[model samples]
Target: MLAWTGGGVTLLGLVMLLVLAASRGWFSPVARLVAGAVLGLALLGLAVWLHRKESARAGAVAVAGTGVAALYLVVASGTAQYHYLPAAVGLVLGLVVAAGGLGLADHWRSPALAIGAVVGAGLLMPVVTEGWGPLLAALTVVLEIVAGIVALRRGWPWLLVVGAAWAVLYASLAAGVAGSAELWPAGAAAAAVLVVGCALALYALVTSSTNAPAYGVLASAAVPMLVMGGRLDGWRGAAVAGGAAVVMLGVALVPRLDRPVRIVALTVGAVALLEATGLLFSGDVAVAVIVGEGIGFAVAAALLRSRPTLLFAAGFGVMGVLGALALPLPPGVLAGYPASPFTRGGLLQTGPLVTGLIVAVLTVGLAVAMLVALARTGLLGSGDGRAAMWVVTGLVGLYGLTGFVVGLALLVSPDRGGFVAGHAVVTVLWTVLALVLLARGIRNTPLRVAGLVLVAAAVAKLILFDLVSLDGLARVGAFLGAGLVLLFAGVRYARLVSEAETATGPATPPTGVAAPAGGAEQAAGDDGRGTWGPPDART
Candidate 1:
């Protein structure tokens, strides 16, 4: 009883001091170290106390709980290699304590006590092996793999988190050692884990209703898999092909999701596109991916707005093809590799000019469609909170900016003087769009700020690229003129909005624009025309 009482008091003091140290920032590091030590010792004492007074079964639980804490303190203190002897002693003792704790774990998912022990032990592996780095490195990977697999099977969250951390640690070590004699074995181990882990992760997502956890597991496994495989040309080559197929399939499945999920799933699918195309590292693939994303977004927007699906199909389909054709096709399909079609061969690159023109036409079409949609819908806010203007801004902003870049490059018109003129026109168009976004009665403040900032970026890009070649006088004059124009326009726009708000009264509920009441009843009558009613009557 006395031992138990003393242990509880010590544990409470350590917990209190640790909290106080963190909150007050009073000798924080030292306080933390002392707290860790005291906590470990208190846990140890509690274990001993339990062994004496409790039934053997309860004693086992107590011992396991205490040992895990002690393990952390032991490994943490021995972080530096110069203290190798002390580190080894601490590591060995901690492992012994952890082994006893693992034996006491009553269930597979008993809060991951055994796995935690191994993780604490894994940290000390680097400190122990000064000479045989590769061997030690492989051991760490194996430990991480085993831990990750166990975590998935048992549904232990921390085990998965720790496993990812270890993978990163080992991957960094492997990167430096990859060119050396140790490369083949390390690569093989990584490949094995990648294939197995990824398969498990995909199975979890497809088979289980839970998605977030599945994704977390898959992402952790996939990143290292890509990194390790990328270094081996043969494996990297095969994996890249496989990844492309998966991404394509994922894209096709996006439309099947419910409306909200469709948005989220498509966004994730876009990431797969980036990954697949990025690894291919060809100019054509990059351009295709960017163009595809723009087209896909446009189609999704049309669908959301309840336009005829056929209209989207026809519009985006033609736009996608034209966007692709405008880029000067490399001398051959392979020419698309290394460099994109937008890049100029000389000051007079024909491909970029053609591509730019095609892009410009498509962008103008999209802008028109969007404007019509907005005008028809009016400046009214969404009655449904499920949708918001900011979401629209974000989606459209992504597509518009991407299209803008391609359009400008195309406008450069492979001719010498045309390049400068094209760039200037693009900058002016960008500034105009930015002004529209800022001046429009946007409900979302962040979206408004983003639009203004994007405009500023366009102005900066213009000065940096188009005017850099000009003489001192021309450059200064252009800068001053542009700055003054922006400032005056911004001020005028603000004043107008301010005045409009005052005259119209502060923003009000959408009750004024309610639909007609009993329209259905009137339409059913002999008169085909329905009688309109006041907004209040509609409700």
Candidate 2:
């Protein structure tokens, strides 16, 4: 009873502390460090107490508490800036507490606890101060370095790596280090620090026991880098590109994500969006940004290519778009696109076409490589609906590109029938993929809704593509096929929605663990690998 009470109080304390912190305007990184430390302490105490009295419930309570604490810290860090001392202090204190807590509490010495402590500490530094501030700032830097060493020596999963990087960056800044953002410093001190941080980040990404820790470290590292690159402009862009390239290479050296590769994919997608929107630059620096993005995307796409490869592919796509946007052209044309070279009224007015064709070929080649990688993972046949969706979208993109090329060719020949044929083929393929997607949606409620919307859109597209010109039996056949597909999909969607509600009804737990059809080959490898398993057997 005492253990249960302690666990309950600790859990409540964590929620209240964060709520209070946010309410009090301490939503910065410093607050996160402090909050994480406090939460880790509370969880440690609860885990210890529970183990002594509530043995059967201990694992559940401990895992839940630890996860909650880690998640809260991740959220806080993401929202907060890195230059706040309070957050850094929280990080250091939390690391110490976690290290001590895990070491002292028999029940809490599990690898998950140790890893959380290290990763939590590494994330806290930027939360505290951005390598500059007052006297306490210097101490924070030194302490983080020391803490990282301790954590590393004690086998704290990714601690030594992430911690070391954070510490060296702080130490360099404290030692009056300065470098133009556009370039990796050629100076001894700055270069050393850069190299060390790169090494550490790569080490964590490649050697960490689990993707969770690697994700946190890499995600956090990417933030400051892009921000710094954005501010510095020239060499910074180059450095950022180089760093990202290194990370992409390192990702190939690591094991695949045991869980769904969703997080990495989302991160890639977000970065791609940022790059595509020109958020990567300010002035003439935009030129360098474009060049770097082009190279980066081409290189990244050529590298990472698997189920986990989604992140790099997305990032590359963004870079490709941004680079295209950066190409020099007339000041007028499409709203977002630069004018075609033809508008300049020169003999080489078709320069964009030639350049675009070259870029297209390169991009297509990389996309094909990505497809091959995904195929190797067997993700295409895995029946993992999400993978299926990704594959379908990829195929659509390929067909669309092919259609564009064919359309361009037909424009010169003025062959209306050929144009119709291209559209018809694409429309047919899309209809089939759409039906499959809708079927897959039966198990995924959100996808099911999206599928309905897509089906409607596809029907409209087919009407425009086929019905308008078809005058005979072909028109009837097209309408009949499309109508049957839509009707069947509608009926299937309705049934799935009803099933979803029932499946999520009171007595049933959410089906969050829908592993792909291969029976979780990756998770099986995680057994004894010091990773947190499903909620029931956390460590």
Candidate 3:
């Protein structure tokens, strides 16, 4: 502790010497730079000699690390403040300091020293560049390379975390965090950084011994948005996103890749695809592409049983729901929020009529596909809450459906009459959809639960909103439509139960429970899925 504290204080004092010299005009800038460099070298020489003895090693390494930081900072000050060296020359000198520090740390096997050198150099970059410009962007790329090498080398997961944190921060700034940065340049540099991250991630996966690969893989997967996110509103943004998506997709396609790596790649690629599509195209065409991507991803998730892919599919599906009703947002079909879906409006826009319908249908389809995938693996009702994923999915699908219905009705009539009429239609639609889900019976427990929940919501709306809000024929139609649908659903359910029993046998209840005349109908609990137990319990 004392050694480290002394090293830190010594570095601070060296910084003060430069400050005092500049304030007092004690020497010329060249003399000041030369003085600092000579002192740093003296400390380095002293530390090398002391490192030869076992007793002085800790303090020796500490002094060496502080000297390296001092030299690097001096070079930065000379280039950025004093104008004593060209930017390129100062940066090259900085790298030499970094290399020397790393070689010493490697010889000493000191992870802390290596971290100090890389981080010390990197942490000084923004100050040297005075923040936000082409120079900083270039510097960021160089820093990313340094960080990547540190991450790829043995011993120092924190180094990667620190590097990634800086990468994300600069990428955000470059993207226009304070709106001061040149967006394209920053975004371009961000792309390079993401590429570096991906390569490191892949290397970690192929060669890491501990947690190095996991951190690298996950960071690579997440960095694309930050890197390209600032300029996603432009063609340059599109290029970065498109290239990133392609790279991730290619990585995912590599045979025998680690499962986590493949999953991360697929997830990031799906996002990049959405961003790229939105960036390259406009309006209905983009929505159409997104719809297709959602469906394809969902179906592929079902086939491949990839939960992460399915999660993205789920996101794409919900983005549709948000788009349909993002009312305040102006023109274009989700020309806004598929890539960033949290921008949903208050159920007002429901988008263009055709676009809403298309997206709503896709949302529902994705939900069904998700359920099908979970079913094959018996994931639902397993106490993992996986069933809720599809339930929320289905609910959003219905939300899009309702928005479009009202939006279309308003489009047709543009008055209170249209509004009432839309609600009437939605009431009937909800009832019918619930019945359809219920009709799937014991084989689909999750759907059955969703059906019951939907029916309850429909009943609440019918009593609370429609009963008071609708007038004359609109109110009559809601009540009448729902009643008839309920009747048909009841008869169909009874018939299906009879057939199920006749095809199988008199339904058997668990031990200690007597079979009633109603048999399986009563035994199956409220969901009519026979007590929806965990998967292994059934067999």
Candidate 4:
């Protein structure tokens, strides 16, 4: 702890000193540049010595101090016209210091030293280039890629993290530059940075035995790319980013890839694709895309027997359903379909209602298809697959049933009163379906449990909402009908339970068991002797 604190303080003090010196006109720019270079070299020498002497923390501090001094020197050089030269010199110095640290014994090569060097050098590109634009963005990407390669070779995972951070920063700056000006090239540069970062991340995942560092790289690259792409180019940029993410998923699916790597890649890819779909499409089209992707995921999960993927598939499937439900029917459809609940002020429409009905039907059909696929794939043996199957089944069943009732209401009823009556009838239909489920449950436990839950829900609705809102004949019929149904259900349930208990028969004693003392057998066995004792007197 003390070593870490001291190292931190030393690095901070050096930076502050340089900033103070630069702020105050303590030295000429030429003199300051020369002095900074001298100090940076001296720190590099000290780092090498400390590393050899097995002081890893001190060595890391010195290496970081060297990079900072190099950066300060480059900034102080005052070569505005030749700014790239200074940047190059500072980058080289950072590499030299990093190389010196790497040359040390493995135990003494701190990842912090590599991270510091990469960060120091990578951050100088923007400053040297004056501000974020195509040139700076390009340089930063190249620098990060180089740093990543070095980190991979030296087994310094922290350097990969530094590279990822630089990637995010560069991406943000490039996006800002693109937004402020008509620089079409800046967007391309940002895209290049994203690609490089993703590649480095994939390399890290492939080469490194652990997953933690790979995840850092992926999030840093993939997430920022996604955000920047969407912000800059809208759908076009989103498609590009989504494609990159899909590439990562493909890499993850390699036969030799680690399980954790594959899982992370799959999750990131799935989310990116879904986000892209949301950005690129709307209404029923978006829902269709989501449903298709969800079904694909479910199929993959079934094949791989992966729970996490199955859950993700289920989540996406639900999102599709929600999207479908939220979609608006066209105003023209409402204009034509005068009886539609959505139609108001006598402005009937047709397109939206038809479109909505079609979307709902398609959504239900897709859900049913997914359930059937899962079942046919024989995935029910796995807990995850079974859960997913049931989730899709329930969603499709409920949505289909609701849509049917609504469509009937719209078709049969042209007025508000008729719509209300239609809903009341639907409630009765629900109750009848619940009863069917209950009857089926007598043969299947799962069906029985589902039936019970549905019946309970119906009862709750009748007592809580329907009873209070309904009036006139509707109210009377609802109560009377619910009461009769409850009575019948209770009677049937009792009979079923009684029959089940009776079929097992009663318990009986073992056949070899002896009679109790003074019972018939024992009395019979002793009676001859007792009677004979009285017979002895008789004889």
Candidate 5:
């Protein structure tokens, strides 16, 4: 701490010398620049000599860092402030100083010096350029390449993060305040950073820890993405995000790539795809596309047998369902098209009808894929996680089934009658599906609970939605159909439960532990085991 403090204090004094000297006319511009350079060289010489003695090695590195900062100040002031050196000369000198400082830091194993070098240079650029986008962006590119190469060689991934943060700050300002012509340079800078960071990620990917390099790769991608996303969020922005998605996916898919990096890439790619979908499509069409993509990701997860992949699949699938409810109904549907679906035209001519059908199919697929992924990854735990999944999948599947039937009914009937009939079909479908799930659930408690939930939802919809949405025979048909289905499902599930209980009766009392009340009692099972209580009570 003392060493660093001394270095910082000395660096500040050098700045004061230049400022105070000019104000007092104590030296010419050349004299002031030469004097600063001389002081910086003296510090470097002192650091080298001190490094020979183990006791002073730490202080030596700190002083070397101060000397690096001193050189940067002199070069920057000479070029931009006093006009002593040409801009190119100043930039070349700056890069040289940065390179030398980083090399020393790496060689000395001094992260403190490395951080100071990258941070000091990054902070000074904005001040010198006064937020000029092109220059700042260009310098950002050069600085990243220099700093990143040196840092990665020493397994220093965090420096890249520090460097990228500055790049992003510059890129953001450029994207927001600078002209369009200047934005591309910032984009280029981001691309450069990502490319180099990827190299770091790929290096020893099989053995090296995944977190450090993965963050570098992600941050490298974030610069242009967040900046461009905030400002250029239409097709142009979509294009950029889509391009980034493709790049990251390529990085992720590389053979033998780190798992964390691959998962990160896939996750970011999923977001990018949805972002593009929103930019390109609206309402149900957008929801359908998002759901479709999510389904595809789910299947990929299953094929890969990856837990992280499945988790993302579950998230995106939920997002689709939520978005469906949050967003308004599609074009024609909003205008009461379902009541008389085609007063003007046919199914092909009705945009919302077409979109509704598409969305319905994808949404249903999303549910199925979620379960398949969970099963693939052995993630269907017998706990709340499994139960929540079942419930969510049931709702998603119900939404899809209802949409599909409604769309089909509207297509065939194209009147209020068809709309009511479509809903009637929906109710029937829900009841039948619930019965299947319940039968399957007899052995899986969570599945049974999900089936019961569906039954409740179907009953609610019949009462709340169908009672008002339909009329005349449509209402009667919906009610009678659902009621009969419910009655049949109830009888069938009851019988199935009885059969299951009879097939697996309670175990015989342990040896020397006599049956309750009397040593011998009447038994119900053919195997001589008794089952005289409610199924749950016996268990």
Candidate 6:
């Protein structure tokens, strides 16, 4: 507490002296900056000298003095009379002094100095440039890259976090400033910095041991910049970002890289590719890109023997199918048509109806292809992996079946009445499917569990949705039909279990165990020695 208080008081005194000098015009801006830098350096040296004996005090003083000096330089450079070069020099000197403090006796105190130096330098960029977007963004990127390198080499992971935070801040500012015609060049420059920063982050990920968190942070920070660049430059910006993402993905494929790191890289790449594809295409083609990428990811997962990636691919594929359902059909194909499927006269005239069919067919084909590929690759050997594969298959099947049913319903009924009737049909379909699954579960546990869940869902839907929306006979029929089906399922399952047990016959004691006296009479078809014998021998 005392050490902190002393450092705080010292920092306050330095700030007061700087303000007094500026108010009274006691010294030139350059002279004051030089003096402050010198004083900060002297204090850092003293702190290092005392570090062994009083490490905490040394750290507090070092952080306070460095922060104060850097602030002075930033404020001075923002003045009309001072050149930007002197402030830049002072900022660099402060960073050097902070870096030197790491060599002191305590490892814990070094992060404070390192984070403060990087953050202080970052804060100075806008003041020095008077908020010029391009220059400030570029400088911030360069600073972050340098800081990342220093931090990685020095093993100060916190400094990487500070750098990543500043990178995001400056990238956002650059994106905001990019909206003006006068700042178009700045936008281009900012875009370039984003790409370069991503590359630098990738390199760090490859080379550094403790850089996993930093890589994730940097990649996350770069995504917005890439998006803004695409928005600014249209197709060209998207192409640039896409290329960088592909490169990152390629690097992630290196055999020696850690699995977690590779997964992160692949994820970032996939996202960037999707965003770029959206910029480059429209309608069905964009949807196709999603499906294609999903399939590709699944294949990669199979080849790499990665379960997590497989799950991701499965999820992505499902989303693509859903997106396809919502997407509009091509204008040429559905010209002069009512937009709503229910308003159309038939399935042929309904755009969404036709699109849904196409999407369903495509989803089924892709799911089949993924299953075949995974099976051929022998990737489903583990129980968990096999379970995941089954789940993916089930989800894909459900999506396709739902699409087909919905489309067919819209085709047959083109009004609200038709819509309600179609939902009722869907309810019946779910119930029947659940019964089939439950029967199949006699041989398969997973299928049985899935069947049970489906039955529960059908019941919930019948009560919650169909019961209220349906009227008169339809409501009564839905409730009655669902209840009967559930009852039948329960009876069938019990009968099968009973029959199986009966076929196995009565239980017998082990050879080492003595039987009760009445046990012999109960086994009338057996020998008197308690071993089963032919019927003729028993008679």
The top-ranked prediction according to TM-score is 5
Q: What is the C-alpha lDDT of each candidate?
A: 0.47, 0.45, 0.67, 0.59, 0.70, 0.60
Candidate 2 RMSD computed on C-alpha atoms after optimal superposition onto the true structure = 21.6
- Give the better candidate number (3 or 5) by lDDT: 5
Residue 286 in model 5: lDDT? 73
Clashing pairs in 5: none
**What would you estimate as the lDDT of candidate 5?**
0.70
Off by over 4 Å in 6: 1-109, 123-125, 179-212, 215-221, 230-233, 240-244, 328-361, 373-539
Index of the highest-lDDT prediction = 5
After superposing candidate 5, which stretches have Cα over 4 Å from the reference? 1-42, 53-59, 72-96, 155-161, 198-221, 247-285, 328-349, 379-382, 435-539
Question: Least accurate stretch of 10 residues (summed lDDT) in model 6?
Answer: 328-337
> Candidate 4 on 248-356: residue-level lDDT in tens?
6675556576777677777777767876776787776777677777777777666666665666777887787776656643223222234443566664344554556
Rank candidates by TM-score, best first.
5, 3, 4, 6, 1, 2
- Between prediction 2 and prediction 5, the one with superior TM-score is 5
Supply the global lDDT for candidate 6.
0.60
How high a TM-score does candidate 2 get? 0.39
Candidate 3 on 56-90: residue-level lDDT in tens? 98888777877777787787677766777886787
Q: How do the residues 1-539 of candidate 6 rate in per-residue lDDT, one tens digit apiece?
A: 45544555554455444455667998876676666566665665665556556636655555554554354334434331254455355446434443444333125445565565566556554544456455455555555665666666666666666766666677667666565663555555555555655665655666775675666564665454464646655587667567656765775566677767777777777677776777787776667667777777777766767665676677678767766656632222221223344244444456656655666666766676567556655643336657676666756665565556655665776544555555666677788889898887775677787788788889888978787777766567767777788888789888976776678654556676654545456445454555543334556
Off by over 4 Å in 2: 1-147, 156-194, 197-227, 251-305, 314-349, 359-367, 381-391, 394-539
- Among all windows of ten consecutive residues in candidate 3, which has the lowest summed lDDT? 334-343
Ranked candidates, highest lDDT first: 5, 3, 6, 4, 1, 2
Quote the positional error of residue 389 for candidate 1 in Å: 7.0
- For candidate 6, the TM-score is 0.57
